[model samples]
Target: MSQDRDAGARLGDSSLLRKLNLAAALGAFLKAPSLTLRELRAVIGVSRPTAEDLLAELLTEGRVEETTPPRQPSSGRGAGRPARYFRFRAESGYVSGLDIGAHKTLAVVTDLRGNTLATSRRELDPELDAAGRLSAAVETARACWVEAQLAPSDITGVACGVTGTLRAAEGVHDVGHGPVGSGLAPYSLPGFTEVDVPGALSEGLGRPVAVANDVKLAALAEHWKGAAQNHRDIVYMFAGHRAGAGVLIDGQVHQGRHGAAGEIGALPMLGWEAAVERLHARGAELARSAGTAAGREGEMVITSAARQDPESLAVLIEFAEVLARGAAVLALAVDPEMVVLGGGMSRGGPILAEPFRRELAKFTLVPLEVVTSTMGADSVALGAARLALDTVFAELLAVPGS
Candidate 1:
């Protein structure tokens, strides 16, 4: 017995086991609501006593609370009382997600349970200086937090999605230097790529911010609550002001070595340049006619005109081919089961989907199911919130030591 005790201590501390078990139970409870002790133990693969002990730890921390167990409509007592259930105290913490795009900045605040408390959006001037745009993005975040009736300390963390590559260690998203093309390119949203995004947002919000590619974050939203729910392998295509894709393998975003795996749509030879030309021309026409902002671009004018204008519908069909070409390239490489069309352009619907399918069929051997994003443009912001929520909970309640 002494030898066994010595061996166990040598291997690891017994307290570590309890901490791990508690983390598992807390994670399971967060994912699923109102779990009875038996169900909780079974779900997390722990003994009933271990589950109860972990639950005691959670209750003592004010992280969980006993709740009424579910009952039938025509309820009758089986014994002295029904099984008790418990849930995480969702109000104990909050998180914010932010989407900083080429043309817009959006922020959403959510409780630990994934409920959206408040949200805000603002159009960004494409020609603004880097500092001004960064300021605007952080302001949008603060505004959303205030709208939610929360304070900076109340936010457990923040996650931001931006257009370019995110360098986590340096806390920035570096948009490419120089012009995207020679002159007058639609992709000419300058001063964004090299900004210290995480540093700026953190300074304003008073909490560290995690950064991810906007399209990748949109894909995360697709998997969590939108078109790609229940899917483990998916390609989420973002086709708004600029085009991008997010690849998910086994329910995780595959960001690639340089965080540039799904940038297929950026290839000039792959029809992205042509698609941008056509889409921007239409948007420019509408902007001139309406006397709106000169720099307006992306899905708004196209989708609006598509509703009634034959010319716009034709343009959309042609551009849908461009979209399909990009999807085909990604699908060929990864062979994803589903392709989710997210971003503002996803609203183009069957007019876009039908023709896109026709063109996409031209490239691949694998069968693919395509769906539009139900979350629309909000996906990125909401996805960022989800990321923040996960990190916050993991940091707050989960055990260390892997």
Candidate 2:
């Protein structure tokens, strides 16, 4: 019996080692796109046989495919025939990210390597109930999936970014009202807090789903492919119809025990609410004067401010001051390497940068670099896709069959 138990332990250890080798090989392919057997063995630090075995398993699983290396010019000294290569099959499966907000729902579909393949957007009525909003998100995702010419089964994972904090309940994730109630007042969707965002989305999309706060996702997007990519610690601020923040410490999102880590705007004393109201009011005035729709108020204010309109620029400065104050609070706590501004208002980041930096300098012990998001409105959705890709990789590494 003891001998049998020892044998079982040995089997487990071998299995674990094989999985690790497989993961290392997959990671190498992901980074290099294609590699010969010799190069892969070098990258993964495995024996030639072990690397070949890993390739075989991955090939059978459709995660990798054999490829011919690019033809090379003949050398005087005959270099042996170019070695065969294996390529990571990024198209083997797909993942999706969704950004659901008060004004719009956006869906992005990406390959395993996080390349955007298709996208769909839908406008939403601020007053739409939670169910209606969820439905809209589902429809948008389906449309995106269709645009990508993919079937439901082609999706390996799904992630949705919503306006509120997300909490785990009984093994499932649920959306909750955090500090600022999704950051939009009077227009915030009703009953959003009561819905299981992940479960609902999973059911609708016919795949397992994950959920996170939209601002947090935006921060992830920035770190993954936008302004904060080179920075390990960052503070991402969402400035537009509402104000919210997302923090990254050591290159990972800092979600508090209840998943509400960077909700500094919830504090009434922080003046986020008041500042947003002032901006909106000014935007409304600008919109009226410009004969544009109310929804264009923020854009009007930003445009006028860009032109150095006295009133618009002053309002922008005041708004920047409030934003900087809240950012200062986060900076003091985490000492992030940079502060990134995202959301609709990020389009005006060039105008807001100096004022925000000036105010942030006044409030913080150290001067911090401030940058605007290059991802723009797509940041949240791309971040969501990142989340989904993470889930897929986790599953692939854990399950040998996968």
Count of clashing residue pairs in every prediction: 2, 0
Model 2, range 240-325, lDDT digits (tens) per residue? 88888999999888988988788887677877778888889999998887787667667888998989899889988888889989
CA shift at 112, candidate 2, in angstroms?
0.6
* Best by the lDDT measure: 2
Model 1 whole-model lDDT (C-alpha atoms): 0.79
Query: What value of lDDT does candidate 2 attain over all alpha carbons?
Result: 0.84
TM-score of each: 0.88, 0.89
Query: In model 1, where do residues sit more than 4 Å from their true spots?
Result: 1-12, 43-50, 73-75, 169-189, 295-311
TM-score of 1: 0.88
**In angstroms, how far off is 215's CA in candidate 1?**
0.8
- Which stretches in model 2 have alpha-carbon errors above 4 Å? 1-17, 68-77, 170-188, 399-402
